[model samples]
Target: MAVPLLSVAAPAPHLIGDKAYDADSLRYWLAERQIKAVIPSTASRRTPYPLNRRIYRRRNVIERLFCRLKNWRRIATRYDRHASNYLARVALAATVAEWIK
Candidate 1:
């Protein structure tokens, strides 16, 4: 994700990800290119980190997407063995949910 997004977007950019991507090497890499990181500090972080509350609030959208996906029994159970079949089912579910919304 970092490589592809960075490749297309110009001048390097601020990246927002959960604590999973928060690592010393990743921070240094982003800083090297002048990307303002809004990543939050994990409990294991040794140094204090500053983050924007407004940006963090957007994370709820991803949580909602997950909850929406979980509504599909096939997805929740991983019943499909093929990737394309699974993706198609997910797309169908997402489309119907959007229509209802």
Candidate 2:
């Protein structure tokens, strides 16, 4: 599902994801695109791929940001009927989140 987005999305140096995305095929696919995968290897894998701990830690920040955004009842409930309105609300929420920080 995400592969289609990657195909059309602007090129990025890295692709960060969680354990759910830690598949050999996906890693190989990202390798072919020269995008470094920041996903950690699943525990069951025989040989775990080396991970950049620093980059992986950055995912936590994104997770926290989403948690904060979801705190807004309107954003969490998707009350906006239009995409533009929803985006505007998200932008407002993000600004408020940063301002409070």
Name the lDDT value of residue 96 in candidate 1: 81
Worst 10 residues of 1 by lDDT: 3-12
Q: Candidate 1: count the clashes.
A: 0
Q: Write the per-residue lDDT of candidate 1 for residues 1-101, one digit (tens) a residue.
A: 56566657776356778888787777787888888777899998788589988877877876777788888888899899999999999888888866775
Indicate the TM-score of model 2.
0.86
Q: Clashing pairs in model 1?
A: none
Candidate 2 lDDT by residue in tens digits, 21-45: 9988888888999999999989899
Off by over 4 Å in 1: 1-14, 29-36
Task: Indicate which candidate wins on TM-score.
Answer: 2
lDDT of 2 at 52: 95
* Backbone N/Cα/C clashes per model: 0, 0
Error of 2 at 17 (Å): 1.2
Cα deviation of 55, candidate 2, in Å: 1.2
